[model samples]
Target: MSDRAPQPVERRLPTEESRQLVALVRDIVSKEIAPRAAEEEEAGRFPREVFTLLSESGLLGLPYGSDHGGGDQPYEVYLQVLEELAAARLTVGLGVSVHSLACHALAGYGTDEQRAAHLTEMLSGGLLGAYCLSEPASGSDAASLRTKAVRDGDDWVITGTKAWITHGGIADFCTVLARTGVEGPRGITAFLVPGDAEGLNAALPEKKMGMKGSPTAQLHFDGVRVGDDRRIGEEGQGFAIALSALDSGRLGIAACAIGVAQAALDEAVAYATDRRQFGRPIADFQGLRFMLADMATQIEAGRALYLEAARLRDAGEPFSRQAAMAKLFCTDAAMRVTTDAVQVLGGYGYTQDFPVERLMREAKVLQIVEGTNQIQRMVIARHLAGPETR
Candidate 1:
């Protein structure tokens, strides 16, 4: 238990309401989330109740339309809330982002009747949802997915496995992507399948380097059946839908990354100032002071990058390039900041006695999830160079 305070990071919210929302989120994080984060994560316990509290507080649907039981907040606000939550615990913050990703397909593409039927339950009915897209072999190349959804009169039978699913076993619903036509991206279709659908089973959660409290598992869909009403968008529109969702999800990742970096920076500064070296604080040294300064600078730059992307999204402008850029820069920044945080604490940082070690481990995952930083570079290049020659 290092007595390190989380470093302060200023936010540029657009409204008083958004500021209030961030305040509410911070209050909940400090009181309910931060206290149990280290203990529960060490025990590999998912804080399902915390999600219930978030749902009750209307934090779950912050960026969604109010018409369908959502908060109607802009992405700019919702992402900041995510950053505050992540500062306390990455599992909860990332969980909310994944839930929002799961909701995107139906919210953005489902018919009005479909929205009326399922969106309310999903958004406000205290249901937790998982996004199912990655397959065992298709981590970076999503279009190469092997899951199959065959049409059967009024129903579709989905069969195959989804890998690295968040909330895999406990989610109330799963927004699934399965191939229905020819090879490549166009064959994919999206379905909102019930979590407990017969023949749909989740494997045991994966043991990981960090963020152990968040369940990540493989899901097996063995002849799981869904009706036409469950389908989202036209046939072959799923890849596009999934891509659009990732554009937003990447921003969520960027925010979460900065939160981790900020937490690390706070820990390092607190430890350096309090711990004595040569009868004085080590922070007084120019070498350590420079490290702290660089860490703080990187975290601020990452926050600014994500907020720019978020603003573009709120304005309904093309933001995919910016989203990719933010995801790449922020996550890389988190990795650096967290690693530097551990260095700042020296031996104390390496031990479980401090949270910086955990922060470092957790920061590694953000670079890989949603899309690898390499994949982000590819996306940015495509945006800049107008797609690569085949």
Candidate 2:
């Protein structure tokens, strides 16, 4: 690999403050995140302190409201910050995205009292969070989830397990969805459950192909109980809230995907230009040059797609179809671009000595998470052709 640092991506910011925010994020990534990413990921160590620093710096709350300690920045600006972070280290970027997703319920749907009580602390008080909607048996078909939350006087007792939860074991709070009335989407309700609540336990983290630094695990809510005040929105409204959150969350995933692809492209270009074959840099080869061109183009397209979706969201317009399209195209493009990047480096890319191999593995998961690419296609198709029926 070349010793040169990757050039920073050029961004169009709405204001000077947003420009400075991205600059600060780049500085943090260079000094704090990128330097330790390889070693920590190889060691499977979670960087909890890094998250604390992010919270303290106010980077954690950029897309939420300022009234409750958030930065109240536009989604377009916030997604750019996420892209910069993911380029350095995906664990941190995706962790931040999942944290924002976890906070969505209360910030958007919670009563004034609930927001006053918890939103400030969650957004800026160094607290981490998790979102619990997917279960072991329910991944894409989320409305089929089996977690039960029964009303018990003033409290709701929850029982069942949540699977594939980001920050599962260490989050300070969780936005959970559970069945409260019947057996479908309308029967579910959302709750802001404290992570340390009695009977809320996380199983051992799963070993993964990449991003070992971020823990993904199953959370067992063994009759976990919380006051009715913790409930978000009206009763039997959890699925709608979860779906709304996901529309935004998919954009986050898209941004992260583009970041990873950009990182891979940078590494490939560095290696191709520096490594000599037959007394000439491999990058001079027409085939390899075209490959690099394609990679760069794909990354740009993905970034543009996600940013468009984010701008739509910021304008208070419906963006679910665009979000799904962004998520699908960006993740699929990442997988392809990362694979081509590995090909660009030849043997070097296949080794742990380089980052492209890791990028390849990481790209695979982006296609699977935040509603899989297949699910994204279904969502887009629904928007175009209406819902599928038997």
> If scored against the real structure, what TM-score would every candidate get?
0.98, 0.99
Per-residue lDDT over 11-51 for candidate 2, one digit per residue giving the tens place of the 0 to 100 score: 99999999999999988998999999988989999999999
Q: After superposition, how far is residue 195 of candidate 2 from its true place, in Å?
A: 0.9
lDDT of 2 at 111: 89
Q: Residues 37-78, candidate 1: write the lDDT tens digits.
A: 999999999999999999989988889999998999999889
Task: Report, for every candidate in turn, its global Cα lDDT versus the true structure.
Answer: 0.94, 0.94
Error (Å) of candidate 1 at residue 140 is 0.8
Among the numbered candidates, top TM-score falls to: 2
Clashes of each: 1, 0
**Runs with alpha carbons beyond 4 Å of true place in candidate 1:** 1-7
**Model 2, stretches more than 4 Å misplaced?**
none
